[model samples]
Target: MDRIRIGLVGIGKIARDQHLPALNQGGDFDLAATASRNGRVDGVEAHETVDALIAARPDIAAISLCTPPAGRFEQAMAAIAAGRHVMLEKPPAATVSEAEALAEAARAKGVTLFATWHSREAAEVDAARGWLADKAIRAVRIMWREDIRQWHPGQDWILAPGGFGVFDPGINALSIATRILPDPLVVLSAELAIPENRACPIAATIAMRCGTAPVAVDFDFLQTGDQTWDIEVDTDAGTLYLRNGGSRLELPGAEPMQGPNAEYPRLYARFAELIRNGESDVDLRPLRLVADAFLTGQPTPAPAFEF
Candidate 1:
């Protein structure tokens, strides 16, 4: 199989830390080019804009767009128009409608458009999903807290209007919940703790109606010690837990089982498979829930956060 020539857009921290390393090591992709205003990858052709990348690297078969969700729709449409497959980062677009439109356009253009949920590809997540396939979940609890300064660093866009803030990481939990649950989830209510100085919420307590049961998600960006990303479910059979970002799973009566930390590698492989099979993978349930929270959630003021 010919390796897919990929152009990476938005070469920020994630591109350097996760995407670049995964692409370089994966056998299915070649880092043919990069498009970023200030960031560049060594040994790869760099362009300041996607237009230049499309014109200069005609051999590029696919583009992995890691840009922020705000302007993703236009760039994704551009890629599809150029006859290239697109793999979007999480929260495919700022709005679910935009993601749906992109999917429709991709189908019209007959190109593969992959919306990635990296956390969904974890081995343990797959196992948990299989376990809960037949069981009934009574409730779910999610605690996803991390130090934004440590995770996002100097990225100012995270606090922008389109930026999700705590929901940025919180969406990962929602993605997993939506996938593992047997029934659909709807946002029931939410409390957003906005910093006086920032545009987005710094902490949040979200409630959801997962099927008949209530699911609660607690998210905080100011957590300092032992950054946690954990989810626990109370089911008819027993309790199921995914701690340490879905890398570990615990069941009712069994020993704790650990899974591989290969989310990015598996994600890239899935992208390749979609391109090879001539299909698009676009799931917006997670993003939709976030959008709903914004529409229906009540604002709760918190102390001003200083970066």
Candidate 2:
């Protein structure tokens, strides 16, 4: 009961890059094992699937899902079915319906579940929320531009039918924006620039509203030059800046605040807390916003993209 033995279900890039280090840092958990079809962490017991991992290590108290959203539903349900706690990465699943179903299933099974928005745990993001609490927000602008090839070179699933291309990164911005803003922003109008050869959009422009305030978001997958990940909100007081994917915050009159690059570490800590407390944290507002955008969005055809 002192340390929960957890199994990592996906050993892809994010697992090796972030989760492995965070799990090893001691936060009420012991990295019990790993399951993956393609990759794995060294020195950990590896299995080909969560089912296999469960069969081998029946003592794993929890299962962390680091796989892409497209396959998250089945894997997570399998873990919950086995009466194990579940932790999911951002966006939860490919569709809002699936995410909701998984949450309901976890609740019915009496197991704790977590759908984490890692960016919300950023220290600078916390600062921004504190500052915005006293300010009257008006308008917001978000530019989340990055090179897909550089970030997801061979992840062909990103362009598949249920894949969320630009939204994969843009949802991180939405997570922070929704966390720090004064009110909830709902999607109004959206334009998705879909490639002729792909199923998902490579770029998107969205207009949203929070009461009378207008919010604009631009998500692009072709910014190979200077990658920009910034959010600016113009309030009655002054403009507030949460830049570098919420690692830096700038208020009207305060110094730029920075935090250690430990977004994943903080995510793991929160997951452990929820599991220990016998509670579930499954907030789907960000994913619901994405779903609304898709439902109300108009498609704008772009040049054919092979990759």
Candidate 3:
């Protein structure tokens, strides 16, 4: 089959690091064009805006948006309006309503809309989910911590009002939890540690529930030393652990399962399948859980953070 020509927007760090490499690998997609304000891929058509890319490359069948969540709704809507399949990065949009509207618009335009959670497509997430399917979950602990300076660099928007802050990475944990666990999760309470100089939290502690099991979450964006992105679950059968952001899994009676992180590749493959099958996959459970935490979280002041 001929590869589908696709345009990518927001050529930032993630685009350069993950999306470009994944798209370049053998897949159902060809990186036909890119739209970005300050970044570009060598030997590829580049445009300054999504509208320009769409106008210039009318044959591009799909558009993948890796832009920041704050202003992604407009770009996605524009792509959907042009009858192009759209794939969104995690969190989908800055707000739930915006994501919902994009989904509705895509459906109305009869194009595929895929809201991708890259972590949920990690090497062992499905295995973790399968193991917990028949077992009784007792408790879940999510500890996701990373240094913003190392990962995000000078991205000040991360601490801005619509940036999502620590939840940006924390939601990855929730995505895996919501996928692997059998029942829905509800946010009970959250303690958001906001930097004195920022609008969003630098760290957070959340209490949640899933089928009567307590789910505790700790999210930190200023963590130094070894970074942690792990989820542990206590079950009637035994304990299940997902390490390296779902790239590895450890179960009670089985040997450890480890694999290279192939999340973006899987995501692109899934996006292609969705477009070919005339389907849309937009799971909002993780986003909703974050929203609920914000709705009920109590804010506390922390020391000013600077990158």
Candidate 4:
């Protein structure tokens, strides 16, 4: 089969670090063009905007949108309307309603639409799910802490109203939790700690319930020591620990299992498969949990944060 010509929009950190490398390594996709205001990819035609890229590169069959969630809807809609398959970064859109709109547009145009959740494809996620398939889940705890200034730098969109704030990384945990847990869950309580200087929250504490099972998620940006992205589960069988953002898994008596670090590669492979099979993989459960936390969670003022 001929390689799918792909265009990339929003050449930010993720685009350079993950998307570009992944697409370059994947055999099913060829990076044909890119769109960005201040970033560019070597050896590819670059445009000032996604619209220009779409208009200029007619051969591009798919467009991977790496822009922040705030302005994802319009760009995604345009790509779908132009008959290009779309692969959206996590949190799909600024709002749940916008994501729904994009889904509708993709269906109307009969094109493949993939809402990419890189964390969901983490090496140990599937293993965690498999292990928990028959075991009774008693509780889940997540601790996702990182230095935003070191990670995001001057990216201002992450602090915007629809930027998702701490939920940006928090949603990844939610994605893994929702996928691995045996039963359906819903947000029971939440506390958002918004930086006084920013429009989005910098920290959040969320409590979720899956029937009788309870889950707690904590997202913090003040960690100065060894950055942590870990999830623990207390089950009737034993304790399960997923560390390094699902890269490694450890159960009661077993040693830590290491897995491949190819989330983006796997994502592109899935996208290619979806395109070839004429299917859409648009799961909104993770995004829904974030929205629920925003809608019903209490807001708390937090110390000023600088980047």
Q: Which one is best on TM-score?
A: 3
Q: What's the lDDT of the predicted structure labeled candidate 3?
A: 0.94
Candidate 3 weakest ten by summed lDDT: 149-158
Structural similarity to truth (TM-score) of each candidate: 0.98, 0.97, 0.99, 0.98
- Candidate 2 residue-wise lDDT at 16: 79
On lDDT, the leading prediction is 3
Tens-place lDDT per residue, model 4, 1-307, is 9899999999999998899889878679999999999998888899999999999989999999999988889999999999999999998899888988898889999999999899989999999999999998899899999888877888778988898898888888888888998898799889999888899889899999876988888998767779889999999999999999999999888988989898999999999999999899989999999989988889999988777
Q: What's the CA RMSD for each of the models?
A: 1.0, 1.1, 0.8, 0.9
Count of clashing pairs, candidate 2: 0
- In Å, residue 43's CA in model 1 sits off its true spot by 0.8
Q: For residues 1-307, what per-residue lDDT tens digits would candidate 3 score against the true structure?
A: 7789999999998898899999999799999999999999999999999999999999999999999999999999999999999999888999999999998998899999999999999999999999899998899999999999988999999899889999999989999999999999999999999999999999999999999999999999988999999999999999999999999999998899998889999999999999989999999999999999999999999999888
Worst 10 residues of 2 by lDDT: 154-163
Over 1-307, each residue of candidate 2 has an lDDT whose tens digit, in order, gives 5888999988887787888889888877899899999887788899999889988888999999999999889999999999999999887999999999999999999999999998888779988888889788889999999999888887888878888988998999999888988888999999999998898999999999976889999999989988899999999999999888898888888788888788988888888888878899999989999999899999999998764
- Clash count, one per candidate: 0, 0, 0, 0
Model 3: residues >4 Å from true position, as ranges?
Answer: none
Q: Give candidate 4's TM-score.
A: 0.98
User: In candidate 1, what are the lDDT values of residues 1-307, reduced to their tens digit?
Assistant: 9888999999999888889888878669989999999999888899998888999999999999999988888899999999999999987888889999999999999999999999887768988899999998899999999999999997778878888888889989888888888989888899999888788899999888878988888999999989998999999999999988888999999999998788888999999999999999999999998998888889877887766
Better of 3 and 4 by lDDT: 3
| Cα lDDT, model 3, residue 247 | 90
TM-score of 2: 0.97
